[model samples]
Target: MTTSVSIFPIRHHGPGSARSLEHALSQLNPDVVLVEGPSDADPVLPFLTQRGMKPPVALLGYVNDDPARAAFWPFAAFSPEFVAFRWAARASARFMDLPASATLAGERRNDDHDDLHSDPLRVLAEAAGHADFERWWETLVEARGDDFEVFDAINEAMRAVRADAPPPTGREAQREAHMRQTIRAALKDGAVRVAVVCGAWHAPMLDVDAFKAKDDAALLKGLPKVKVTLTWVPWTHGRLSVGSGYGAGVRSPGYYDHLFTTRSAVTERWFARVARLLRAERLEASSASVIEATRLANTLAALRGRALPGLDELNEAALSVFGWDSDLPLRLIERELVVGEALGEVPADVPTVPLAQDLAKLQKFLRLKVQPEQIDLTLDVRTDNDLARSVLFHRLNLLGVPWAKERYAGGRGTFKEAWALAWKPEFSVQLVEASRSGQTVHDAATATATDAARTAGTLAELTTLLESVRYADLSGATPVALAALDARAAGSADVSDLLEALPPLARLARYGDVRGRGSESNTLAGGTFRTLLTRAGVGLPLAGVGLADDAAATLRGKVNGADAAVRLLDDPDALRGWQAALTRLADRDDAHPLLNGDAVRRLRDASVLDGPEVERRLGLALSSSVPLEVTAWLDGFLDDSGAFLIHDAGLLALLDDWMTGLDATVFQETLPLLRRVFSRFGKPERRAIGETLRGGGAAGRGVRRELDEDRAMLAVPVVLRLLGVTT
Candidate 1:
């Protein structure tokens, strides 16, 4: 006779919960223990139950579907599940994962929307308590450190917290089928009493009757499966970190890492690691210093009277002993320890694009986070740049890869993109979370993109797209033009494009000025010079003769806008452009009134024009003048006393010794001008300037003199004269 057995739903990974579970199981001592896992995973049980099978190693169940998906429930040393497994195995218990076969296609489908439908209950409960659920969960479950009963109570509370979660649309059906399958396995094996343990959320859904409607093969048979394989991976403490996402793990991963890795309190070990890391980074800290810091850390914990130093205590200790403030040691430790260079890898099988593609993709399966490294991903979207960008973005959208978007103020076709990538442990953790989306990256990408594009105008869609910017550094997403031309972004459409374009143009302009080669250096990078200048509002031009499509009209517009008093010497050909623009502004075409005075001032400063040309302009200005403010602005440009010192290096050479009467603005502007002036010197003079800059300049005269005398000049300066302090 088949007897009804109780299925106790439990959290996938909880130290305390596992403890309570072990207690319950010991009390029940059933003939068989049914687990909510892949039924096909029986072969791995012995390996998991091996004498040396360490706590924290997980029995990963995956579907080698066309697109593969996996479930990771890592076993911690104090994990209740680990303890219960020990109990069951020692008692010669038969364990079975009665879930539907985790097919690759199904895994892919699940990966497609893994966290997109995150429970609203997490949000609601979080809001109600004015506390973060992840932190709360960590404290009660993971962070209790060897306290399993506390973990069980906390998880039980969380079940109640998430009790009112929205009903699963079809996931329930899929889960129940797996349940019935497990029950069928038990019945076939003729087990009298069976104890099943799974997530509390799945508890209510278990039982044979619940899955009575499930068609074992019909419901799951068509799902594309893949021949995926598995291997052991060293789990890091930081991988369990949680914040602002679906599968939140823990807050202080560094502390938890110590908890799991060491046999005893390893706060001192953490300190040693931190000190060594700091020294490796060229920071000086003695062994005594590290020991003292450890002592302080333990003291801090004792002051508050905890079992040992938690992450907060450690940070406080670091901030006090090794830092002036709370930033130094932590920053050093994070770079050295948190994202360590030890991400475990497992070799993937052959490249197969079956229905279970998500199960394993292209002979590569990153079991955990990659060790921190600089990643260079060059995407080639040459075929149809637009189509390629769409696909890339869609795929990245599914994988949750961060690449940036760009637009051209006005241009078309492919534009280059660049990104710098650094892999963190959290990224590997995210991989597990994102894997629930689809079986294959293609399906996940395509579906995610289609849905996003469908909701193109919605706030949610746009926010999600914008959110990817943070990860842009991770994936080198560099399609410049495609991003700018996004038809869906309305009103402020091409602004992003203009923004992307502005950098290159501005850099080009700056490069020219630095080398004195840009056309903007002549008169300044005019608005017209940059094709993207009009796209974004702020104008920061570097150099080059600012030009537009229509040379004549552009020239005319620039000259007439501010022609009269511009310093043409600043531009080698300032007189010509200024003359043309000045004439236009004076001829009763008052549209670009601002440029009239500036053009004339430039021509005057250059002194290229004879007095007659100046007189003629003066006659017109007096004849039909406009705004007083306009004229005053023009006069102010002409009033600049340092017009002759436009370039700083030349001005500084002459004026550094004569600073008695200098104004603040002129002094402030002197450095750039002097550099420019010195740059413009003739070849022979340039060589002399270079020599002076090297060793003969005033700043290094004493050193040069000593070198001439063949003596080291790095000595205290001798006082040449005695002086008394006078008020």
Candidate 2:
């Protein structure tokens, strides 16, 4: 039996188009319906129909064809395709997607389409009946609230564009080819009638005869395909948003989400909700203020003769009403209302990897088990432990689980991880979303793992990076990915930041112990782990918790952080950097003691000091103290680590050198400056005066000390370098 099938190209979730699609699908009564997808997702349709599953979820599709190179397709709940899928399932229509599937030859095929979507955003004045495509579509199709008219207008508008702006290869080629294929497949099965639903752009291509004349098999020539799996995962408003992308009119998807969900969701409603949410959260906002702002928005809208306030009016209302005119509401309101409570369900029977399924179950369980923001959870995944808790935490993380780091972690290996879970709805949603980008746990964990390998500037960033990358490397992602990070810490002058990046990386590497990787890893891991501690050698003033972003992670700091410089006496990174920073603290003179203390401690800890080496260098320094090598070698240790330094170890010695200072000519110049320093800080600081009154402190003090080294340090060096002495 041969029956003419109708193909509808319409936008998903478009109330107007969807309404029309529903009616058309219901009326046409086609035998089979084809939707657009990677064909591999076809198997998941049954699972997608699960009652627990919700819309506003994405079909996370991945191509492992090339693990090194991958991309994603995210579909949200309000997506038109999802709705169509539901309609097909309900109708019991033999539904299927018509894109390349099972064979992902297309995954490897480079279509070179990046340039295709880059058509100019240029808008002609008043031609499309609205300011831009978005406004035009909203006014003509969406705002009218009439699906029939929406469908008609869409078909007409799309036809006009199709006729005028035909895609280079052929505007109507795809659907025509699809229609022929559908007809042939039906012919081979000896069944009739079919319907195809695709994007509006494909509408003009649906007529069967146009492509029936071509070789259907040949038309699919070189159309590659690959294995893929599609699972429903929640999507954020940002992903659906389209300020700049392929989708249209979703300038602020958060707003559209509100608008589309509730017919109008006017300004007052939006402002009121914001006020209420804030007040509920104890953020100090009032309903009266919101009402006032809503009135203002309404007034503004009336001036424009709009029935209700648009985004501008609502935004202004939010600002005028409850917003602090700065960025509080602007930051939070959208996330609260627009994305709202997005949740996706994966059926137990859905075909998926064990890890993925485990992640899903974990997320579902966590969804119901709400814990407070600040938390600490200790999980023991030992040989005899309950499998549930162990699997649960990993699953949450796999799903981007939100956990507050523990105050203190005890023990080592996967069996001993200290995890604090803060099971938030959004975190789980984000986790699910990440699945679209990366097929497995490792891939989705990119955000944390890659972020771990940071520039490591401050302890704050390093700690944050550590917290973020935790566990991401469990899938062997810790190679080149982590090398630069290790080198970064060693090179980092901020002793605190180096200290921070180490523990987390060490923890991850240690977890590899459970995975059975090796002892070299443990050595490298311990070496890397303790590297910061060693670098923080003794008497290095404790850098107070660099940042307390995580209460738990910073807990250990409160206990032992103040003692890092004092206790970790021989850590190399510490000695190298802080030792230099210590040398400059002399004039403040508060610094010399700190540095000298650290050097002394390092000597004690290492049970070694280059005494002869020191003496040899001391002779070389005196023989030629110049701005360059000869002069530089002559003076005491100094660097731009802190304030300027006078090289003499004690204040009295520094004063002695200043009094003796340079030469008769250099003395005339240096004496006045010494007198000035003595007058400025010399009196108020009793300790400085005491040091100055004291005797010569250390031989390395040389001519310069914390008391009298300045522009002269560089100047003296330059002169000595010129003298050509044996410095």
Candidate 3:
């Protein structure tokens, strides 16, 4: 019997194409079915027909040695190629695709080249006077009933498109040649009936008799080959959208899915779903509105000369019937219904690296669902489960698989941590790559961090790495990081670097007990803190001298941070050393006025300098310094604390007298700085200070004033009651 070959051209991920292909395949009953996919992925093809296998999954092909070099062949339920696979499986026929080894081994192509073959659809849509190719396809094909004649139309259109288009060359030529070769091999294997399902653009070039075998072989000749591993990974609907940068992606996977799944009452059911979602969000969407929306959508479709309502018509109907003023409701519909952000599931037995499997088990145990949408997770380290979750997040971050990004935990306390978690499909390949370090997440993180710490060249880098290690609870990596930190700190003469290094160490020392590491972490972190602080104290005096304004401002911030760290540690010896360094900076005549003023403020805030001494220093600096220097010193002194001026009448009086005495040019030049200082105050505090200035500034100094003795005596009982005293 002569083998009859039938080519079924299809649009990738088209529901109508999938339906028509299924109908055509059942009628033809082909013995061999060829699809356009990676030939090396044949081994895992059986998994597609197995139970628990879901749509929105991808065939992941990666280099054996370096999994970072990877490619994805994604499929949705409505994808024509996916439908062909199921049909072939049910009919007990052979199915295969072109080899992906050459493709994976080749240099990564730009997205332009990746999507070049799909341009025929754009040309056809443009010729049809449609602006969007997806909408054009949806109207002409996806909205139609299952009919095999649609394939014939697509084949004819693609043939016309290819006639004027240049012949395929480079990688595109090789892929089509390999595809034809696969078909020829199937036909030569004594199959009486052969069916090929491929991209519409490539269909015109795949006639085996028209292209000689030698030409196809020569086209594939000299192609680089590499060992590649293939596995199935879960994909997301969001990733299936063109907005996500998938070159061959559809504009509306979720809408296409609804079209494919809903066999009857498509418009009514869609409106019902919209109403249900709106009601779920506590928005008013009544049954009458749903009915009106369905009718309106159908009417719009009729007016637009469409057989059924497309997504655009339905969205308009919903907007009109629901009477929403803002586009927020529409956006919610687009995100939740149009794009449908959902992560697909893979069978537990699917092939993956050990690290990926381990992570899956951990996710299940921790009650963390792998989702495509980002979720904010707040963890309290005081709880065992939360602490474990935090550790896992930190470990994954250390492994360079940032599934969770650490965000600021509001309202202080080291026990609280906040993270933004979102799972991407590419993390599977990242897990495979990270598995080279170790077979498990924790072990891999430790290995990666330890390697980083050993290679880290700067004291600041070592300190930051050590902090991450502590957070991850990587006990194995902590010692290596601490050793590296010590070695780097011992040789570093940069006081700024030393100061930068001290804060994380101080935090580790103070909060180690809270992290469940107990006294061991405390001792190690405490020792490091003392060493860095001593070095910083030694170099700080010289570092403070001969600095520019910007550098002085930056160093002042570092000083503030280091002081806060020392105060957090609350060790008297560390505090004494830090205070001595500040004293030296405060007494230096050659230091920038800003730093000098900040140092004096720090000393006064620490109460090491009494009130009289602070007054003396302030008076001398204002009288002896230039107008610019006086302004800078006042800024450093009053940084972020306008309440201080309100509370200290003598200091405020000194500042007022200096400012009032300045010449007009000097006052105007310093006006901006004065405004900056006052801007930090709260509205009420600013008003109170202004009122104090207007009232001759005696209220803040507790000047004696006349009072009604009888009224005061009457409030004594209320005061005693507030104090809980019994008379």
**In model 1, how large is the Cα lDDT of residue 172?**
52
lDDT of each: 0.45, 0.48, 0.83
lDDT of 1: 0.45
Model 1 regions lying over 4 Å from their true place: 1-240, 243-247, 303-305, 334-344, 350-727
Candidate 3: pairs in clash: none
**Residue 315, model 1, lDDT:** 73
Model 2 weakest lDDT span, ten residues long = 633-642
Give per-residue CA lDDT, model 2, range 564-618, as digits (tens): 4323333455445544433322122222222322333334234343444433433
TM-score of 3: 0.88
1-727 per-residue lDDT for model 1 (tens digits):
7575756655444433455577667767877777655555555556556555544454454453421255554555544455666777855344343333444335334422332223322343466562333234444434544333543453465456446656444545555465667667776677777777765555555546644544543454444444554433335444544542326344544444455446554777888888887787777668987888889978876786455665667777787777765476677666446533333332233222232245234213422113345554333333344334434443554466543223332222223333344444333334444455545555554444444444554322332332232112112221221242233333433332333333323232333222222242312222322323332222211110233324323433433222221231233343354345333433433433233444454555656544556555544543442333233323322333432322223322333333323446655654454454345446665555445545555432422221323333333233222343333
Each candidate structure's TM-score, on Cα atoms with residue i matched to residue i, is 0.43, 0.58, 0.88
Give the residue spans of candidate 3 off by over 4 A.
92-98, 111-119, 131-135, 138-146, 378-384, 407-417, 513-515, 548-550, 610-635, 653-727
**Number of the top candidate by lDDT?**
3
RMSD of each: 15.4, 12.8, 8.8
User: Quick one: ranking by lDDT, best first?
Assistant: 3, 2, 1
Error of 3 at 232 (Å): 0.8
